[model samples]
Target: MTDSLDPVVAKFVDALNSGDRQAFYALLTDDATMSDDGNDRDLRQWTESEVFGSDGRMDVESVSDGGRSLVANYTNSRWGSMRTAWRFTVSGDRISRFETGQA
Candidate 1:
């Protein structure tokens, strides 16, 4: 059976590939939290900086799942290849909580 998270992950990948910060941020909640191997920062702040920064190119390699959460494989211009997991807590059509980490 097809994974329920496939479409959401696909949309995120598409946004990342396109370097569309607005679209990318739109996928996240206002209070979304993202934790990377490098630093602990809020998703909105990190994304905003990345969107405007000089070396913020993100190439999404693949997206997978671990039962409850989705994992995204990516290569950033500055960070190299890293696997990031996004655990989604959905509320209506939007995400109430988004926690990410290096997998």
Candidate 2:
């Protein structure tokens, strides 16, 4: 069956696509963490400031959730197209922790 996290994942993707930094940040916990492949950096707080910045564009291709995880298909001018997964640890309707990886 489809997981319940699908809508949340979709909203996250939509925020990215619309360049809504506030909306994107609102979906994450203050201490939430995100990592990519073997990159030894935490992409939580700086994602909006550094990655999206003020002009980056994102196009969401799809979204899927597997209860505890969320995968998003998207394309961007800076990062190109990729299918990435964000594993989430939810706490009281907020994502307390998250990790990103190729899907």
Each prediction's TM-score against the native? 0.61, 0.64
Alpha-carbon runs more than 4 Å astray in model 1: 1-6, 37-40, 49-68
* All candidates: CA RMSD (Å): 4.0, 3.8
> Which number leads on TM-score?
2
Clashes of each: 0, 0
Candidate 1 lDDT score relative to the true structure: 0.57
Clashing pairs for predicted structure model 1, backbone only: none
Cα lDDT of all candidates, in order?
0.57, 0.60
Root-mean-square deviation of candidate 1: 4.0
Model 2 residue 89 CA deviation (Å) reads 1.8
User: Per-residue alpha-carbon lDDT of model 2 for 1-103, expressed as tens digits?
Assistant: 2235455555665676678878877887887676667464666444654357644443333434456665555455566667776666666656666666678
